[model samples]
Target: MGNSNDLRSKSLWMDIEVAPDARPLEGDQACDVIIAGSGIAGISTGYELALKGLAVMIVDRGRIAGGITARTTAHLAPLCDDLTSEMIKLRGEEISRAFYESQAAAVDRIEAVQKREAIDCDFRRLDGYLFQALNTDSKIIDDELDAVRKVGAPVHRLVGVPLAHCGNQHALRYPRQATFHPLKYLKGLAEIIEAKGGVFYSETIVREIEERKDGSVAAKTDSGVITAKAAVVATNSPIVDTLALHTKMAPYRTYAMAFAIKRGAIPDALYWDTLDPYHYVRLQPGEGAADTLIVGGADHKSGEADDADLRFEALEAWARNLIPAAKNVTHRWSGQVLDTIDYAGFIGRNPGSQNIYVHTGDSGQGMTHGVAGSLINSALILGDTAKWQEVYEPTRKTPSGIGNFVRENLTAVKNFAEYLAPGELKSLDDLKPGQGAVVRQGLSKIAAYRGKDGALHARSAACTHIGCHLHWNSFETCWDCPCHGSQFAVDGTALNAPAVSALADVKTGD
Candidate 1:
């Protein structure tokens, strides 16, 4: 809240600085593998490859581990967050079982890595509760129980969780699910990677990734180029593929808030509901006498909503009703997740590229997907075989998920049609300080923002990803593209990808 133009809000995990000594790339470089992002997936992949004695160079447009990973609630649940029942309907039982196995293995990999590296990031195994929301049908719990069991996960049918007003609620308890301080874990992992000869470059933007005819991949950045035997695009949204992968997934904006609570107020476990946009709750052990209760929900398609305050209010009301012991809010922020039509990450080789690989499509399970993708992509890069490869194949198609595919793609169609609609404001004069609006000007839609300092910043309302219309996200104070999850700063710099370039500036007669 200090400077809305800089950052709208800070996530609870942003306090930790990762790879503090890392510098931006200055010139041409070479490595066995070049990673385009430094999030959990990128760092974990680097750790895996570096352990094998491979020279790894990781780069990011921002600070290391400062992307969406820092904004996540750090839930390491391996079960399908979108509902295993629905996933089973889209993917067969065999594939669904493999998906679960891979996700669970991701959690296991985190446990193993933390132990091996002696990283103390509050890593612990806990029970996960998927209970029925108040007044909602209990059949979701039953169906999930059956579907999860079919996937060979250890789930127990139970009644009620350790929350108020949920004494008689039907629930499923999945043990061995995990949670952690993502920043701390990544910080330790980054140190370990560096210690093992892996290099990290923060504030390095990879503009284009190309697989050269010589069988090597080159990541072109503004500073220079990085050549490697292979490359991985771990950016939250893959910037390499324009249409194929983008069409298979949709972006969602999810909100989370943390509240102060007594250490023993609520059990240390993961809690989620059976609601469509399910509520997820967990506890983080604090240094002082008070612990932190983190609750998240109220998801909507990115760029489709600008009601984060209302969403936070809804979350607070729901949390207070269920856990009356929750105290004052400590931190509140939001992150974006890409939901795939098939409910699994797209990990492994990028389609049509031999030396280039991609890891994306978190599907609301970014933590697990990131670790699992690290393992899968690292193996594939090392010329080793991964058993779960087919489960997360980037090029694979789910014929059964056709309905979901159509439903999600319709968002783009509707978004494209918005280009013809009138802007939110007729002129920039209608904008007030600390506010932003799309203004119609001479047949062009301009994204206009009046800063708190009385300065006006204007750019094209069209997203550079595909020229789809951009919408102002008041909560995050950024422009969100409804088409493929590209986000731009108020000053027109692209924050998230599928779009690397900044928004085109509008010519204003001053």
Candidate 2:
């Protein structure tokens, strides 16, 4: 795994330690259930199973809770982030209603868990506002109001939020939505799980997962193999499957920035606009003179764009336009979300495996999806039928989303075509210190990165997951695969899955 030196930016949550003393797996271990990732989903799953008295082991390639969960803005809204109207159009009213109920339950579960565990994670339930953007039709708000009502969620029609300008803007108010300090919550869960005998292995990479003939699953790592009655691959992108789930989802890079603002300058609530790529705003309570206002938006296909500085600038401008009292930028970071075709996650048993399960395709609702998916998966593992299983079944087909499926899968077709094109640079010499690029060397393309200290690291540009061409992400300082959401560090170590192995080193003189 890459270290702090490899990361170009950090999230506000990185200031806290989640599992500071956590160590990698040293030898063979056996548990009733093994989870491959330790973000909120994996940790939450372990908590659910551990509560049921099952021996659980959660492993991650990096520090515990250091993955995308730490990068999240921590919006716990149960309503669909992508608009419930669009979701109902694709998944139908029945499945969409079930989806809404399950998501609400997840939020309730989090509330109950924090109170019962006494986790003091700054968890709070507040009203959420969905307002119309400037120059946009108010019909969207009406559609959403009707759709949310059809899904059985409480909503109130409104006109205007506590922001600058537009006192008469059409909006809908959703009561009892939530926000939290994600890392703190996960840290509490990690401690509680550990106290309950759940094991955590940080900096441990699971290379492969195989289902045995005797109905047990084995997770093979470099150090040893872990055998379990069942396994869950909750890595943001499922590392176990190459095609099944990957084809149904696409990766998107979303940006978030926090700014300092005087307390009481803005109400403590979740505010979102009705835009294609919507902007979200919330406040994080501070102990000092000013609280932190987090605003997130500016989403594009991962690996397709390298304009993060511009995106951050746009976000800052948008924030200031709405809240003139917004002060200096405190933190800016980006995270990847796996958007499924139908705007819901795929959480269930792996398509072809008996005991192997997966939880992925967060679709921008990761905070709630993580908890909701855990409930569904844990129930199935305990031999009970999950109420919303059909809504999120990994193997289920979405005939309604065929158009979206085709449109998203085209990203792969276009990416593969890049292989035949010239590299971003003609040679490695063109790369400068603290910079990286894809350089052409004869017929092969090399991912070349020069450290701030002027050390050259080179690797194959092809993604280990499916040989898709790699794109350099200037913001995160990593190579991203547009095909399957694999991310590699400057040294070619796979940072995110569905690619477990590092990028192959380019041979000398190639």
Candidate 3:
């Protein structure tokens, strides 16, 4: 487990394949709408609107379809992992039925995309599992199974031989659920989007989106502006509307380790545990080695701990217990998602704004809810009626919503603490090789680093997005935030999306 391979860093899904047509936003763009992300939601929604005769434009800060789509475990199933039964408790059986139905439709939506476009991303209709562990509450799954049956989703009790000892209670089996390569499917649809009159711009960072007096919205970018009738903030967590949208969705860090195990070591069906901090496992096709087992889900508050390795270790132990013979761990990586208070996603107009829509707070089930978000926003933008509109409406509220809102707001305390926390090292010169430092300078903490060139350089540690302090990440040689998931290079350059703005400056001596 201590081997570097067991705790891999980059995305296994991406390292294995290549999508050559991927490009960046080159210049100014104009269209009926400007989609702000290249993930599944942004790409698919843009394609849908393009086919409907609207002139659409898609833009990404980096290469198209390179964000979450690149690293997703891609569990394409309709079993709402968290919100299925919670909906029944909070709202009623009808909304509960709708919630389950929404996921079922998400599974079908992926299937429909593959069929209609004839994509060859290895899309397969397989059984999905939500297993209960010893530490999990059985009542939750019991209630969810009833909803699954009522909604006629393919889920029920099934006993798995390999996992019978982990307090193996009755499982919810969703039949016809799928698994696929996210980037492959997205790249396939990107072609269709362009062919359907949609414009795409890479390297074009959308700065701000606001409504004008004449009723059109303006999307200011680096090179030029895109004024459209409507705007969609599909930039993962809605990079705009910082105070409102970021507060509702708290970021959670989850780890994934794809390892090659001996043949027939893992059961083919996708499996997930019902533990408090759960784990999900699945198998993917591979060659010249053991089967690739993707074990994921060790959720933590993003950037708050900085001990992702410990979480990765916990995952290794979990895997060894299930399959002690497994070895040759090839890749390890992590992703962050916006978790909602209601344990569901927020998809629709950004509550107070007019004609500006957002889709986030997907929890760990981002794939299914992401699809749901696209449909919800598309329906709202087109004013098409759908039963899912109300439940996932951005303006809607519940007791859980209020609770989640408060829970997410506590990050303000973490951010406040960062401004005052003690330095890890005395000074920039003290930084060891292959290391980064955050030191205080006139009440402003600077993210100083000893570069690979062995020279020390410093920059304002303040995150350009919302002024949160940035911490040094040893593993990635980047400055990461416990706040809204903005990542930056060691020298204060933006490496990830949603920030789009570079750090203020650098002061170097030594």
Candidate with more favorable, higher TM-score: 2 or 3: 2
| lDDT (C-alpha, whole model) for all candidates | 0.91, 0.91, 0.73
| Every model's TM-score | 0.98, 0.98, 0.90
C-alpha RMSD of each candidate structure in angstroms: 1.4, 1.2, 3.8
Q: Give per-residue CA lDDT, model 3, range 1-510, as digits (tens).
A: 012122225786664332345445455556788788878888878877776788888777766765666667888767556646665666666766677678678768888988899987767888777777655567767877776676556666765436536545656676777887777777788778877877777756787888888867888876888889888888887776766666667777778888887667656778877776778888877676567888888877766666778888999889878767568788888887777776677788887777788877777777788777777777777878755877677767677457667777778676868778777776776877667778876667878877565867577888887888787666556776767777777656665545667777766455
- For model 2, how does the per-residue alpha-carbon lDDT over 426-483 read when each residue is reduced to its tens digit? 8787789989899888888898888888889899999999999999998898999999
TM-score of 2: 0.98
lDDT of 2: 0.91
Misplaced by over 4 Å in model 3 are: 1-8, 15-27, 134-152, 158-161, 164-170, 288-290, 495-498
| Shift of residue 135 alpha carbon in model 1, Å | 0.6
Q: For residues 1-510, what per-residue lDDT tens digits would candidate 1 score against the true structure?
A: 113325667888999999999998999999999999999999999999999999999999888888899889999998888888888999879988998999999999999999988998999999999999999999888888899989999999989899999999999999999999999999999998899999999887899999989999999999999999999999999999999899999999999999999999988999998887889999999977889999999999999989899999999999999999999999999999999989998999999999899999998888999999999999999999887999999999899989889999999999988878988987788899989899888888999888888899899999998899999998888899988999888999888888999888888873
TM-score of 1: 0.98
Total clashes for model 2 = 0
Spell out the clash pairs found in candidate 3: 8-332, 24-202, 25-201, 25-202, 25-203, 154-174, 155-173, 156-173
Backbone clashes in model 1, listed as residue pairs: none
